[model samples]
Target: MNRRGFLMTASAAAAGFALAQAPGAAFAAPVRKALPRLKTQQVGSGDINFGYHSAGPEEGRPVVLLHDFGYDIHSFTEVIPLLAEQGFRVLVPYMRGHGSTRFKDKSIARSAQPEALGADTLTVIDSLHHPEAVVAGFGQGAVAARAFAQLKPTRCKGIVAVDGLWRPVPERAALQKDRRGFARKLWTANSPDWRFDEAVFARAAVSFDNPDFAAILTDTPSNAAVPTVSAPVLTLRGSASGIPVDDPTARMIEGAGHNLPLEAPQAFADAIAEMVRNAKWRT
Candidate 1:
């Protein structure tokens, strides 16, 4: 099985073990928390019904936070509240092929190249009724953010990215033994727990099912199109994540790894808050 498949198996095992410890666990439904200002919403974009989590006041400055591969909106569970409390309208969308977002045209492959994602993002921006907004993202989501800034320069005020630079897929000799091994290595490398987070991979199962995105995602160019981006950009990386500091805009988290947002949520928030302040954006 591929890494995504294996991780789901592992996560199921873990959840099963927890259930075995408590009889009737299977029968008990999960308790939903009373998360004020936190809601999952949908917007009708052409050819897609996008599902996303919305937070903060309706009239606040809008900021769209996109999650990395294998993560849904929940990846921003901690960060969303932080941004929302800071008086920003935050939207964490389940990217195409992730969570509840789905493509309406059955014939279209679920392509996730930045170009496609950029268009979708702009559609969401229009749906939100915002003239323009800040686009911040992680991993593959960063690709989407940068793409949006590049593709729709007028629709973005600034950008915040964490360790999402895409390099050309290394030569086979420099990579894992095979496709599954390579994928697993990466999936765990950037993960918050240093392993596939059960919830994360489970949420990404649908994304993995789409074979159309593999080439664009796996064979990224070394200079993954950051230079053409017009808006102000702030790139952050964990000290441990080997993402190269090619761009002068890049910064490092003192002691962290790929999932820098989770490792240093406040610092991440502060960087974004500072970027908003620097750009003089008004909510």
Candidate 2:
């Protein structure tokens, strides 16, 4: 086999191992240990039960950090401490189909579309009873972050979307139909970073076989979404990542990619700090 063929085969295996998904199927989710500082708690919102980790000063400025699709609250283990020490109440919740967060009514739709994620995020924000919060998200979570910022501007004070917004989110309907193929392609392109960071998420990624990949991948981006964000917004990505940067507040870090939180924690933290500093929140 040629170099390209060899590379393709390797990537397919890695993505298969990492995401554990079939074409148009849910990703698998792994079990994870609880953090000492992060209190494990659940909030019943509407018919959904959201399990999340929370720490830091409750009276301090609130910040809600959402993890990428393949990860859970544990994703922000490193960054949350920093913000907490700096007097920020950090809340990291599992997405709809990841971790302990779940829908109370099985009869309800399980679609993880951007709109659904946006609504769920709002539920979390309201349950926490934070009048407003600085919302930050990575990858799929970033899309959720954008939706939250646009749809719930009154509750979302500012948004810091790293490797999430203003990027080329490929709309491939076929990917949903062939999730395994999508995993192969995605992992092939993403394995280099995965190899370096799976340790942070792998064991806890048991449910990698369950997230709504197709609905997420093929979900349409609303043309009117960006203009609706009344709160401040900051878009960021790694310089090495080919993802686009179209926002005025867009920023970049050298040699980073979708896994910016792990590959560049300091830079990611810096970006969040910058977002909070520039946010037009009430004093």
For residues 1-283, write the lDDT of model 1, one tens digit per residue: 1110001111211222232233232223344433333357788658777888888877777888887654456667678889889888787887776556767877765665567777778888788777778888777677788888888787678888875555444433322223333334454444323433344434444444433224334333344454367788888777755344344556877777555666678878887787766664433
In the range 1-283, model 2's lDDT, one tens digit per residue, is: 1100001111122333444343322123343454233457898668678888887877777788887654556657778878878777788887776667767865777764566777878888688777677888876677677777677777677877765532233425545455444443453244333343234444445434444434433343422133356777777766644233344556867777655676677877777877776766663
Give candidate 2's whole-model lDDT: 0.60
| Model 2 Cα RMSD, 1 decimal | 10.5
TM-score of each: 0.72, 0.72
Worst 10 residues of 1 by lDDT: 1-10
Task: Give me the runs in candidate 1 sitting further than 4 Å from their true place.
Answer: 1-39, 168-184, 191-223, 242-248, 280-283
lDDT values, one for every candidate: 0.61, 0.60
Once superposed on the true structure, which residue ranges of model 2 sit more than 4 Å away at CA? 1-39, 165-188, 191-194, 207-227, 242-249
TM accuracy, model 2: 0.72
Q: Candidate 1: deviation at residue 78, Å?
A: 0.7
